[model samples]
Target: MTTERREPDRNADERTMLEGWLDYHRCTLARKCEGLTDEQVRTASVEPSVLSLMGLVRHMAEVERAWFRRVLVDDDAGWIYCSEADPDGEFRLTDADTWQEAQATWQAEIDIARRNAAGFALGDLSRGRSGSGGEPFSLRWIYTHMIEEYARHNGHADLIRERLDGATGD
Candidate 1:
């Protein structure tokens, strides 16, 4: 499916603006993966680098679950594709990994993130601490961090897509 990404409103309130940009970046990632074969989606940007469109989807899914469910709602949402033993498991795809599965999982996590964030104000503090020992994160902080995370990864995605098929966009 084609991703429909909208520009974040310039005059929106703080929360609205943050959510807008986050959704934009989310759709940007999805757009990057569109029209590619499963193998193409799983292809790494470079040798020895596990980063791929599929891997980014999986990694973002993990990030969404971590920041929204585990930290925000204290839901004990364990990693879906990663673990304590292999923190980067999402990027290390196996033969079983597929674009459809990774996309669905990432979208599911995004849905959960929206629901969890809806119950709290932007200033609300997380129920859990960051990285097992860091300070509690405010919803504001999480939103900001998520945007930055996506922005950086989306840059990687842009280059990957260009390398794979000469596709490029905002």
Candidate 2:
């Protein structure tokens, strides 16, 4: 992949720090899919689990769209994949899903997420549901959550990638 993952600076402001870390995790996920074919990426490493590198990409795209477009932006932008009919569609990758298209959509959602967050301050309240009282969530909270989400999925990607070709690293 062309994108290079960078480390977050310690001396940066909170917003920059959060964004940097989030970006780092995002790149980590992308790195796991680098140099892999569509069929290889579609292979599930663990039995009884639909986990795969491409599935993770698709899932992250849905996450970005949900949090940034529908929640953060307070727009009624519909879901990306998961729905009543196919609740786990994001993780259900087949030979039909080319790596290029999945990667493009994921990257695009990340860009949109950045744009949505740019228009708000860290403390800015999102219309999305909060932890309690049905209150709005903060941009900072959303950023932190997104970072955690990527970190967890990146771990899964690591296992799947290693099993796929014996390749491993951050």
TM-scores for every predicted model: 0.96, 0.94
Backbone clashes in candidate 1 total 0
Residue-by-residue lDDT tens digits, candidate 2, 1-170: 45698998889999999999999999899889888888888988789998889899999999999888777878777777688899889998765778888889999999999998999999999976455677788899899999999999999999999999999888
Candidate 1 backbone collisions, by pair: none
For each candidate, the alpha-carbon lDDT, in order, equals 0.92, 0.88
Poorest stretch of ten by lDDT in candidate 1: 127-136
Q: Considering every candidate listed, which one attains the maximal lDDT?
A: 1
Tens-digit lDDT track for model 1 on 113-145? Answer: 999999999988898646556778899999999
Highest TM-score: give the candidate number.
1
- On a 0 to 1 TM-score scale, where does candidate 2 land against the true structure? 0.94
lDDT, residue 143, model 1: 97
Candidate 2, which segments miss by more than 4 Å at Cα?
128-132
